[model samples]
Target chain A: MAQDSAEAANQRRTTARRELIETQIHEHAARLFAQRGFAGTSLGDIAESVGITRQALYYYVKSKDEILAKLVADLTSSVVTRTREIRADTTLGHAERLRRIAYLTVMDRARDRTRFQLLDRSASALPPELADAFLEGRRLALAELRGVIEDGITAGEFRPLDARVGALSVLGMCNWVAWWYEPGPDHPAEPIAEQMSDCAVAMLRSEPTGTDPLAALATARASLDQLERQLRIDNRRG
Target chain B: MAQDSAEAANQRRTTARRELIETQIHEHAARLFAQRGFAGTSLGDIAESVGITRQALYYYVKSKDEILAKLVADLTSSVVTRTREIRADTTLGHAERLRRIAYLTVMDRARDRTRFQLLDRSASALPPELADAFLEGRRLALAELRGVIEDGITAGEFRPLDARVGALSVLGMCNWVAWWYEPGPDHPAEPIAEQMSDCAVAMLRSEPTGTDPLAALATARASLDQLERQLRIDNRRG
Candidate 1:
């Protein structure tokens, strides 16, 4: 039993070391690909950046294409999974859910701006299977967002508009952050995420027709009371 | 005099021919670059697509970068010029102007979807000077759009919000068309442009509070009139 436990501990340490090297490979590859166009980058450059031989790099990733595919898959799957969770949350109102989804997406893109930009600029250079997988992930995310918007419209929390267009508009607003957001003292992620999510919600809000019906009724009742008092005084004066 | 006229006509024909070939080169280059990424394409490929030898193609463009720079310059200048014109249009209300600008942008992206997509996917591959020029044009366009939103707020036609965020949101909605818009019989451009523009306008509209003041006053007066009649009857009975 003692020998078996020691072997298990040794195995765990080896696994952790491998995982760390793989992560380093991914990071170096992403930086190189973002600096040079994907087509311009090579496995050798990534290996050199990560302080490994080209042969050693292959132990972590099969090819440059594999690195790109893994990076995109990681990015897309996380986003799609979170979006699905947001869509499935029944406790939240549709408007609030939509706002959270928008916030989540903007922050996701902002946090991974470099990877997102690299993907945006190099998607066509990806292998066909990898490209298809990335696109499928995007479609799935869009469907989840569309489902949320449709629910909002059905619940009358959102204005009646094409849910697909609404989804795309919200996605666009969030995704464009990847292109323009630069992390700095003046432009932090949370505030920009908040503002963008608010804008997305604003775009979908149903125009209030003469205010809420209850509020309108209350105002009307108050005016009637005041007018009645004035009329009573006038009648007495007469 | 006859010889001089003939020589002038010959010169004009030569110039026209040169312009035609240059246009063909650009179109073929855009298609190839869009299909294969910028870094993946070559001058020889563009020359072959245009039915010219690489040596002959060099007469028109000094390098592949020049071709890309020209295409981007053409696209950006036209958009910047149109945006500036819309911004300066004093007769139109701010809301209308903003709607028109949004419509124009979406339609512009739709019309040149191929080139726009190419630019999006290959911007980082552009030479530094060309990239700077493109970025400058983009900034100019954003500034013009933001100015319109700011004017709308000042004129009380739009709600007070961050004009920069509003402008980017509208731009994101329109620019994203380049990514997803596929022209077909079922999906027409004009209607999509119209809907997006309306959504942009809706996003900026000041929420109506109990309807317009004139309408609210009219309602109150009508209520007062009815109350006065009812009171008269009550007073007589009493």
Candidate 2:
């Protein structure tokens, strides 16, 4: 009876320990991946950073690529889930849903910028299976954008342009922020999110009635200036 | 006199051989770098691909970074030279200059995509000195766009948007094409260029005549559909 109890306790401990190791590995891998890139970093380096033997790492996870797959998998799944949910909301006009998605995407990235950064850069290093998974996730997201474009057209709220290119333009504008974005010290996420959403929405509107391009552009310029200044000023002083 | 003639001939042959080796190194490096990123690719692999010893490759170029830098330097110089010559014309509006630059960028990419591809991916690998050099070249080209935008705003030809952000928007819409653009089998360059120029002009028009939101939305949807079908059916088939 005592042996049976001990075995149960041991199994529970192993599962808990495995989970802890995974969480730590993920955290360290993200930091390292962003610092040196996926290809530049090795399994051994990750193991060292995690304070474990290489053999111990192998016991917990199969390879570095698996760790990357896990890191990005949540993001991909979230995007698709959000896109599908947004698309199914038939009551909202296409433009309205698209605007919501845009606003939400900016906010999402604002909350967790590191995930976006890793997903963008490490996409090339994904093996075939994970690559397909990632690509499917991307295609679903892009398709959602196109659906919004189509809905907007059917609803008569936007101009006619190639949906794919328009989608690309909107996404290109958004995804680039991962590389250059910084939250304004003076303002918070709300204002930045509004401006980014407005930029996407304004670009969609066939008419520029009362549009304010300078507002967002000024904000973007100031934010970029802060980033460049930080590199020179903060890096040395800190 | 005969000895002097032989010396000049031999000098020309040596120069020709050096140029040939340099070209070979760049070609191999670009292919390898694209397949396995800049950080992932090593000098040994590059030399092996070129069928030369590591010492011989070094004799031609000082280091791997040198190969990356030269690729961008040549392209950067070309872009600046082209932009400066156009800016000197002094007879075009912001729209026309934008058209010219967009077309030139596209045409240049089409003619020698390999060089520009290297520049696009490897610019971040540059050392501080090389980074400064390459950035100055980018800034020079961007400044030409800035000039056109500033002039447009001053002359009341464009709405009062921040010229810098607007400049990037227009350039971003154009340069991002390098990421996914393929000269489609059905649509050749000239017609597509003309249409793209029209799109850019339409984007910047200072005035907007209010149209029904619903109709505008429908038009946008149609365009997006066309674009989706237009994107290469297989982005990874290559």
Alpha carbon lDDT of each predicted model: 0.82, 0.68
- Relative to the unseen true structure, what is the Cα RMSD of model 1? 12.9
The candidate that wins on DockQ is 1
Candidate 2 local lDDT, A1-238, one digit each (tens): 9999999999999999889998888878887887787788888998999999998899888988788889778778888788779878988877677778877876776655776766665576667787788878888888888878777866658654556766766665555545445767753666545655655666665533223444334434554564476457646856
- Tens digits of lDDT, candidate 1, A90-157: 99989899999999888888877888877765666777887788888889999999999999988878
lDDT of 1 at A8: 100
State each model's C-alpha RMSD to the native: 12.9, 14.2
The residue-level lDDT of candidate 1 at A14 comes to: 95
How would you class the docking of model 1? incorrect
Tens-place lDDT per residue, model 2, B20-114, is 99999998997888777778889999999999999898899888888887877777888888877766676887667766876676566555556
Model 2's DockQ score: 0.07
Chain A, model 1: TM: 0.77
